[model samples]
Target: MSFLIKNKLGLARTGIIKTAHGNVETPNFAFVATHGFIKSLKEEDYFSLAPELTISNTFHLFVTGKHKEIKKAGGLHKMFPLKNPIMTDSGGFQVFSLGWGKKHNIGKVDKTAKNPACVQPVDKSTRPPARDVSKTTCVAGGVRACLPTGRLEKDRNPVKILSDRVIFTYDGKKFELTPRKSIKIQEDLGADIIFAFDECTSPLHDYEYNKKSLKKTHSWAKECLKAKKKNGQMLYGIVQGGIFENLRKESSSFIGALPFDGFGIGGSFGEKQMEEVIGWALSGLPENKPRHLLGIGAIKDIFIGVGKGIDTFDCVIPTREARHGAVYSMEGRLDIKRGVFEKDKKALDKGCGCFVCSSGIKRKDLRILFKENIPEAQRLATIHNIHFYKKLFGKIREAIDSGKRSNLKKLEKHYKF
Candidate 1:
């Protein structure tokens, strides 16, 4: 399996990723379906919204049943019952093993702006914190973020899963994740594209720690390949070197030379550092192989990523954000439960040209429908966000094919890439 870069705009590119499952088009987006399902969107809905290949989680599945069980059940392809190609993470990235950081919670700064119910609770420190009782926000037309406040934190406790095999602690629990276990799990799941077990470090870590972690990851990746070899399955080597450019260059250069099918840009760079790191990593990477940016799938980020030569990205942003009643559109994003759309008849994106937009579902109708149930609400939001993702990639790829990919930055203001 290999990725062929057919066109280039600066460092950005349009390409094709040939996988055993099938093929994933370049500059594409894959919605995360951890465990067996995507939260609110049905498999049919997903195909309808984007019709692109998708990826699933490996760690979560392992926790429930052994990988051998899945292989007996006819592998992930039969278990998930999908026609498009599928990809799986190596289960080593602490994020998947951990969840959002419940066991040993760290570095989640709270950003609050005028207590909007549409926005989640803001914690000045710690992970996702409690909601501000003083704020009021809406989701859909009239669906207010009207939580009673006393039980929000208890309801949505997030954490990261690790690969150390022992359940590590966070807030107050242990999250034990091991590499061998992850490899076994993904192998049974049998995804077309698999990632190596790499530690996702924080940007605040010192140079020595970063260097040590990267080296460990390299060794672990090699071991992962040895332990979980599968015919037609492709493995990806992650490039991790934190915010230091020299380290990033070295890491990318070294990882690029390895006998891996593709590459993934893992953590160590948060939102602020995302673009710069992509630029540095791609500097020494060969254009022949596919490059993926892990956990980034927003519209603006999509443009920036494509412009910087990322072929694929996977994130729960669309479905997760939509679960909170937020929706993305061509014009921009607005919380569906906000006060502004209470009676608005306009679709989430008037020009979106998707089924949901054409469904003529009123905001008030959606709000009332969701009050009846969260799944119904999540479905509508998922529809809109999926459309947004599909459109972003489609436009970028079109630009690349048309020899105008360089102008993609004009779609947004910040031109970091």
Candidate 2:
């Protein structure tokens, strides 16, 4: 069966993206499993998070080893035994992982995927020559990167600045990325669904630059479609055009028309433009296919997108923020590190039914709790944020089940959306 789109509130959706492992409830949050799974959490640990799905990176897995080995060992399900739907990113996000240093500045890259003008002058003798063609950090006009997120982790240079074309040396080796190589890696990974490769234009791009970049991305998406052939596995095209409404409309229409399993609005569109993007997309695209909004999972954002008809959302804020001691609440968030929380407590939240809130009493405020080195604080904090997310969606699912979709808005105000 297709990934089920069960319910809708405004443009946001409460549904299931069914996969071989299981059905991943939609309009969900993703804890960064960038290193395969959350750092300290285990397979059995998922029950507490109760996440509708898990997301990992195709780029990370390929860099570490082959993903086919994962499938052979029973796909990710057997290796991890999480028993929930998992989604794999195509590693397209690395396209903007900027390389910064005195030697490298951000600018338009050429066909070689190298930015020449980003390099600023440095001491000719002390620093590596600006025109050293043999260096791994230069392409055409000559640029370099400081941070390398795209290449094989082994090939990073401590001093090398990582730019689009130039890679840093890790243990004294450099890594390079070409679009063809990325597509091949994703095809081999064999996830239930994979996104097409596209450059993520940061909000910094101007209209002309973003438009040009989106055109290149559109062409690249076509190339990925031509190169990839995954039977039964779905491929979603990403639409990128910063915040410009016209560019968003153009990119959405173009990508939406492509033959694919789904479409993801991947750009600067935020809560303010959620409905605009959705309304624009729905007008030009087919409704049967799923719509994924990259990096959106806040309470208000969910309602805004769902009301506009978005099917799924993935963001690192929930768990990342939670891990840092920030707890999501109805009114806003609790910055657990603040002094106000030192004496306050009361189970993180009174409205939440999560284990953290249910099992607890007050007294272990931030000061005393951290002073005593309590593990419950971290666990309680994560659980509370997770409950806030679940409760937000539970209401949406209930509204959809009852056919009172409009009620989602009435409840959303309490959450500060």
Candidate 3:
């Protein structure tokens, strides 16, 4: 695998990632195809959208025992109709997702909002006995009493984090995933690009926690490299450091020095700190190899990432939001389920070339379909949003290739960013 830079505008550039399956353009978006396919879309629908790249979840396939069938069928391409470049993430994010994310009810981006799942710490005198605690709700003088803060501590997390591996408890069963096992699974699944297994820390984790996690992540990266036996797949090491600038730069320098084909900037941070965090993460990375921003795909964030020299991104925002009746357009997102659109006759987006728009599926029509609980509602919305992102990235590449900053500025205005 090779990354060829065709054009450069500041840190942003237009490039081609040469993969075994095909070439993927730089500053592009990889639509999430979790569970082997994009949810609610059929083969025909996927073919119609014709995404340039798509990513699948390694943990989901491993847990569901689908990797065996895919390996038997000669990889994801043979098992599915998708022929474009595919990327499979290591199950690292599950460390945060299944553990702290579930326990704290938080997401990758910390909004600085208080966790609703958390309660005030209880006074020792007001606390109920250990045996009665299970039978009665935390109450004091007819008011809801605070609970013990220790209940939400690290040990209470459903997923156990270890130095070399992680143990996930799901659906009443425990599954262990090690660095070597993660790489083996990705190799068996046969993707053009695979990620090194690293512990993705949360934005809410304090400095001391992230520092310890970073050491484990760095060790896993080396183990993943040693575990790779396939010469065809390109492995990208991940940089993890939570939200600390020093840790981000340290991880970046360490992972950047590795022999991996490319690099992925993983872990979570506050929304406001994205640009700063990305700068710290990319400071020590080499200029030649491709850099991917994992799990980030907001329109403004894509522009920010590309400007920071990120080559690719993968996120569930487009398809996931589409399934919930949100439609992406030049004007902004539209909620098709809203009553305001019930009598509107405009297309999903004016002058859009997507199948749904070209077919004259008016907002009112989609609104009625969603109201009627028809399955096509989600499919139509998904197709449109996917095309919107495809077109957005195309325009971005064009703007970069043209060597014109004005073109990029025009896109920001056009997208209402």
Candidate 4:
């Protein structure tokens, strides 16, 4: 795998990531294909959209035992019949999503009205016997402090975190995933690019919690590198530091120094601190390698990430929102299901060339389809939304290639960012 930089404008640049499958343009958006396919869309629908890249979830495939079938079919590309490059993230984000994320009810960004404590203690009944539990101190909110022996005590949280692995109870079945296991699963999936297994911290975590988590993340990165045996797959290390600048820089420096093909900025951030957090995360990475901003794809955040030097990104916003009847446009997102659009005859997006828009689907028509629970509503919306982001990134690459800040400024104004 190789990355060739073709143009640069400040931190933002246009480049190509060469892979066994194909070359993916830098400053691009990788749509989420968690189950080896984009949700609510058929093969023909995706072929029409023809996304540059798609990212699958290692955790989901592994936990659901789908990796076996994927391997049997000669990997994701053969199974999905895709010609574009693919990326598979180490099941690391599940460390947060199934752990603190579920416990605190928060996502990558903390937008809750009330902030929870960084460390909430688990219920006493869930702890081990007094003799065994005495060795470790319980932090507030049920989080157990690492014992002097370097072992972690299980908490009441649905997901259990240990020094060597994570335990998840999904669909009433227990699944254990270690760094080595994560790497093995990615190899079975045979993605062109795979990520090192690192714990994704929550925005609610404090300095001490993140500090300890970083130690585990850094250690796991090394283990992942040692476990990878595939010759063609590119491995990217992940940087995790919650929302702290110092820790973000520390993690970036540690993970960046490793010999991974590229780097991914992971972990959580405050709603308004994404730009600052991204800057800190990229501070110590090698300038020549590609940088991916994990799990972020909002229109405004995409510009922020590109301006701060992120090369690629993956998120479910476009497809997930589309499935709910939200349509993407330069003007803004439109709720096509709303009654206000009952008589509207406007195109999904004026002058857009997406399959749905080019076919001349009217707002009222889409509204009627959605209101009647027709499946085509989601299919059309997903295609339109995916195309919208693909076009946006293409224009961003053009703006960067032109070496004119005014071009990018026009994009922000045009996109209402």
Q: What TM-score goes with each of the models?
A: 0.80, 0.75, 0.91, 0.90
C-alpha lDDT of residue 139 in model 4: 39
Model 4: per-residue Cα lDDT over 109-160, one tens digit each: 7653122342233222212222433223333233332222222234455678
Per-residue lDDT of candidate 1, residues 1-417 (tens digit): 767778877777788888776777788887777865577777687557644766787766665554567789877777765656677886655452253322223221112221222222222222333454433433422222223456545554444322333343445544455666666677778777888877765432446656776776766767776776567777888888766678789888888878778889876454455678788877777778888888777666777687777889988888788888877765566677766777878777767776777888766666666666757788787777777777777877887777764356555552222
Which candidate do you rate higher for TM-score, 2 or 4?
Answer: 4
Clashes within 3 Å, all models in order = 35, 24, 0, 8
Each prediction's whole-model lDDT (CA): 0.66, 0.60, 0.85, 0.85
Error of 1 at 132 (Å): 22
lDDT of 1 at 49: 61
Order of quality (lDDT)? 4, 3, 1, 2
Candidate 1 lDDT for residue 132:
41
TM-score of candidate 4 versus the correct structure, residues matched by position: 0.90
Per-residue lDDT tens digits of candidate 2, residues 266-359? 7554324455655665555567778877766766677777777777777776777776677776647877677777667566666677766676
